[model samples]
Target: MTMTAYLQTMERGDLDSWGTPEDIGSETVEGAPECAGSFDLGSPDDPVFGGLYSVTKGKYRVTYGFHEHATLLDGEVALTNEATGETVVYGPGDSWIIAKGTPVLWDIRSDVARKSYLAVTTDIPA
Candidate 1:
């Protein structure tokens, strides 16, 4: 089946719940190759703050995070290291790729939404 068909099937199925403050939306960028649907965590600060995401269409990446969140399961994240200036790609079922003191860039090849488990830095003990 094509990617679109796979996405359609995913929409029909019930994915495992990630966290709270569930909010969902989709966006289609102008001059972009594909459309994207996302479920967002309700945290106002930082990326992946207490939420889960799934990419229904294309590829995506995260650029910055003021804080870090722990991962409960395997997930995909594309990151560029600020210290080495290198880019790395994580595959499905990978967990907690991003943590504190990490700066990176995200490149999304397609429209993608990821289920994320995020915890703010303040909440995490030093």
Candidate 2:
């Protein structure tokens, strides 16, 4: 297969592999949530990668290690900024950018939530 650039549609069924329960580090705070992802563009260690992520019903905490721009593709999620204690609810079609090192609490509101994201491991230029 030739590796080339093409437009990829984000769908809920895009994820083909799933993480073990509570595999998202030691930050799991609530119900056991399993996450799955499939990279359509690049690998996780690449400077830039794009993929679809799906999480089962649960809540967890995460500290961003990379900058990510993502849009909710399915279900709902309440994201709280640990530093400011501010919460924002995101539904399908909503998009946001999270900076590296930002601590966030993720609460899945529906049975599951899916998002399509493009992440940058290096600094994003202004």
Candidate 3:
């Protein structure tokens, strides 16, 4: 038997994970929202970035054509629906899912905001 594939740093007190930097390109909202933690390079089966992501502070808009699952690890973010003008504030120990093709505004709160996420694209409904 072999015991391998372990993220020891991920088990630390801090939510921040090391390595795995991703490029959001010009899609970043503001304050250079970055993955301050674990970011995967991806593989064949799961060919998408997944891990702890964080943003210092700021607000930005995005049109999500795919589903996104996020669990707030620290700080807070206010998600406002662009279409319906609806908004929800999420904090630590909180989580949410954004529907596909939905327009959203991300309002980052706190000095440094962080979260663990798994985002992917799918044509099917959740």
Top TM-score prediction, candidate number:
2
Clashing pairs in 3: none
lDDT of candidate 3 over 5-99, digit per residue (tens): 32324543344433222243224466645445565434214635566667667766778755778788678889899899999998887889887
lDDT of 2 by residue, 49-87 (tens): 887788888888988888999988788999998989999
lDDT rank order: 2, 3, 1
Best lDDT among the predictions, by candidate number: 2
| TM-score (C-alpha) between model 2 and the true structure | 0.84
Give the poorly placed runs of model 1, Cα more than 4 Å off. 1-42, 45-49, 54-65, 70-77, 123-126
> What C-alpha lDDT does candidate 3 achieve relative to the native structure?
0.65
**What is the alpha-carbon lDDT of model 1 when measured against the actual structure?**
0.42
Worst 10 residues of 2 by lDDT: 4-13
In order of listing, the candidates' clash counts read 16, 0, 0
Our model 1 lands, by Cα RMSD against the true structure, at: 9.7
What is residue 84's positional error in candidate 2, in angstroms?
1.2
TM-score of each: 0.43, 0.84, 0.67
Ranking under TM-score, best-scoring first?
2, 3, 1
